[model samples]
Target: METTGTRRSLAWLVGIWALTRVVLLLFVFKVYAFPGPDVTSDVSVIYQGWYEVLRTGTFPLDDVTWQYPPAAALAILSPALVFWLDYTSAFFVLCFAADLVVLLLLLYAGLRSGRTSRGAWVWVVGVPLLGPTVYARYDVMVTGVAVAALLAGARYPRVMGALTAFGAMLKVWPVLLLVAARRRGSWVWAALTAGVLAALFALAMPGAFAFLTFQRDRGTEVESLGALVFHVARQYGWDGQVLLNYGSVEFLGPYVDVVSTAALVLSGLAFGWLLVWRLRARSFHVHTLADGAFVAVLMFVTTSRVISPQYMVWLVGLAAVCLCFRESRMGVPVGLVLVASFVTVLEFPVWFSHVVASDGLGVTLLFLRNGLLILAALLAARELWRSTVPLPTPPPVPTESPRLRETSLPS
Candidate 1:
């Protein structure tokens, strides 16, 4: 039976979430009437354009902004299931459905664990705190797949692998979840599933490999952590110019290439750190796996040259999954993530003009947001390390031999 506190908490969460969504949707509708040129574009135009291309039996490989993997084609086509409705309405409805699915899965997992309700609380509070970006972009769908994979990882490794593979097709990041599997067979299952999916898509799509080339040529997005360095440097008379490229604000000018290359190097270092952690880890509990996955993803996002506002959805989803385990002691880190996400909304839609100008308030917001992420990343890494490193077994107490016992016995 649910406690009174749980009931009250649930009510509050649902109420707040609903109110936020309504406000965000209203804002989105107003903007759709007078769309502006932004990184995300008008949701209706982007989704409807892709849907039209898919309806013609052709992938959107020719579109330069269509940088997602072919598995994303399904999500693009999903809104069409309600074709009777207009594109914007159907797409928003579809995204809302995906959001609910994630909430249900997190709640079910929390209850089934027979432990604390921290997991459900994280999802209830965290997703909405991310603001409208949660529904505006398709990253929420990928987050759902990742959450499902984490839930099924220990009990059904193959299923977990398949889900992760499907998510990776939508966005390359979900593939990182495969590292959380405990069983050796889980690796094979994951690899096999991913490989098969890749092969199938390659056969079906005309330009299946196009995204790779597109991704390679991309520059450093203006919102990334690395970009903050340039933002600061601009005050010192840096000559870099910010422009829209690859569907994001990017710094293009002298030494921009150098900064981009440094971001890649940091990513490589993060990957190496994960590898080292994996090899040294002695504990493999579900909670530990969730925590590890969160750390890995945090590292990936912080180090990447493009930390989009919607990317917070990925971290929020994984952080909620981490809290599902009673053993997870990530309350502080998760709180930091929540604050960072709220800051992200402010930096984007609220004060975006200041951000573009790299003004004092905008730089300060980015600093706080990025600083919180860095702190969260460090704290999560520390927690995972301490938990996974097995406690040393004390030397076995020396046992007295039977002969010694016999000799010592009273005659």
Candidate 2:
């Protein structure tokens, strides 16, 4: 049951994780790098907006304000109260430490689902940390919720639903899982998600529902694949206004409408594919959710006119969530995501500049990094499609959950 090497490996892993914590603390505290790095990145601005929100009970109303979903604004503001330090410093480190929360949640989800073996959960921890992208966005927040939701899918549907709903409010993807998913496969899951979301929304504001109305009026940035057409328009010297001030950017080209149409068509197809996948996928495999999420992010990144660096965090976070489940099952895909994460960081900070500088090798590596992510997504999808490993039944919580096996599907 227990071997000396296994014990030694566990000890070493714990030591390395502890070291990671210390190093991250150093990075946050000014020992590993600059003392006062300029707040120039988009994430910095986002944090600034959150800080402002916490300082005063206001969320961004327009592009000038960094308008995010009301629920998300609250989520972002949450850490401010938790850490109680200077916003920037605390924001940076707490976000980093959130990954640790993810790890604990990963284990908790597995344990509740009768998935306590080292093989079942170790990869989730080992692989994501290896990825350089681990340092990226707050996707870990969403992952923590999504995985917890999935793990609760079998026995505690309402609680699962509440988590998923809360995640959807944070970012739109979790909602897709909630709405696009089979209604009865996990009604308790859906109910819980919906309840959690409703509760959060109720607490956010009486007018919080109104904030959701303004998103369609918002702007899309140059980060998406949609920006490619904007670039071509500039190349042709078209003189239409590129973007409007409030939220959405408006670009002009002879084929601008056509490209928009194409983007919609492609995105719709991708969405449709996921819908079909939901229909076919019966297994509650965590990789199933992770693989699908990766595909969704890939579709968005490739087809989106705005691919913000923070977006990578979303995919990476979900990938890490999947790894938690994977380690309990298989190990390889976790390794792939981990490698992709490193390549992602390597390519982004330094390599992105090189590609823009017209270095063909830089472009090659760029594609390579993206390719690794694609490969990882495909690999995980294959396993999800092939492996019908049913979701583990959750034991009862003092709070009741939606029943799993009794769920029925839409015809």
Candidate 3:
């Protein structure tokens, strides 16, 4: 009876959160106003230069308009046929659709777990007050597909592969989940995904091969904790440049860069090592794949030169997934990642600009936020480690056959 009352209280809290979020969304649309955009981050700017290439029957290159990969351009351009130059409203539609996709994926994931209600709760609450992701960026399209693929691991992994392949075309991270899927029949499907991705990339853009070769020559900017290095280099009076060839930054302290490079390499190796461990042990489990993806996401956040705010959608969605399935005590990470997500945005667009305008308080608050995220990730890591070792496994999932399936996720 006590637990029931507590759950009712929590459910009420969730309801209020959802209600406030809805009110906020209306405020954004009607009262607050989107403020749309001025040239800086305008809708046209997103598909800015890509249109020219499409018109000319060619692909972009040489950092000209920072042309994204061929596959990404297709997504950006697809909406244009219907919405035309109005990418803003189109973006809103895309974001809304992404939310729907997330809901479907959540529902499917829950059904596989034999916990449909749990999945529904996750889907309903996982969304934010900010409306949809495509409102400001098209990354949500990729997110929808990537998350669907991973979550579908519970029911239909092959379908997951197809969806992940589509997402990898939008952004490449979904492909990494394959590394964790080593124990299941992921490799075979992953190979098919590779073929589909290649064909799509080539077909979408006439200069797909050239674009691939061109990307190898570019690098990312400093963001996330990686920005600490950039800050240090600036304090020491050094010019920073991207070294795309090595997938890192250059022109800072050669020694420091070397160390960063080494750290980055070690990180990649650790993930590879995990994959090898899973494959060799033949431990193909759904929770295992989700956990591995969590680790990979952390690594990407900590190591990447650029960490954008929207990326949090991925982490938050996955964390909700972990929570829905009651896998890995994800509530801990969900709390941490939420803080980290907001802070990343506040630091970048907020304080960085404030510092330029000589606002010390802004900078301090931003630093505090960063500190909070680091602390959260650290605590979450400790919890993750503790949760993984000799942890009580969930009950066996029921099926008509009741035989242990190769892609079993404990409970």
- Clash totals, every prediction: 0, 32, 0
Model 2 lDDT, full chain set: 0.53
The estimated TM-scores of all candidates read 0.90, 0.70, 0.72
Worst 10 residues of 2 by lDDT: 34-43
Once fitted onto the true fold, the runs of candidate 1 whose alpha carbons sit more than 4 angstroms away are: 31-40, 391-411
- Model-by-model lDDT, in order? 0.81, 0.53, 0.55
Model 3's TM-score against the true structure: 0.72
- lDDT tens digits, residue span 1-411, model 1: 568877787778667667766665665555543122343354767777888887776677777778888888888888778879877777777777887888788877877744566776787778766666677788888999999999888678878878888888899998888665677666777788878878987887677668888899889887888889889999999988989898778888888889999999999998988888888888777587788889989989988999999999999999999988888878789899999988988888677778888999889988899899989988988888888877678999999999999999999
Rank by lDDT, highest first. Answer: 1, 3, 2
Model 1 lDDT, residue 68, Cα:
87
Per-residue lDDT tens digits for candidate 3, residues 1-411, read 976874685566457545745543453244453322221253455465565556666666544333355567777666665556365555555555666677666655555533433544544554452233324566667767767777766567777667666677667777666655643456667668768778876776576656555444334344444445445555566555434233222324345555456546755775665555444444344466666666566655555544555566666666656655655555566666666665554544444444222245544544555565556555555554554445457999966554546447566
TM-score of candidate 1 versus the correct structure, residues matched by position: 0.90
lDDT of 3 at 131: 37
Q: After superposition, how far is residue 187 of candidate 1 from its true place, in Å?
A: 2.2
Report each candidate's C-alpha RMSD, comma-separated, in the order given: 4.6, 11.8, 10.8
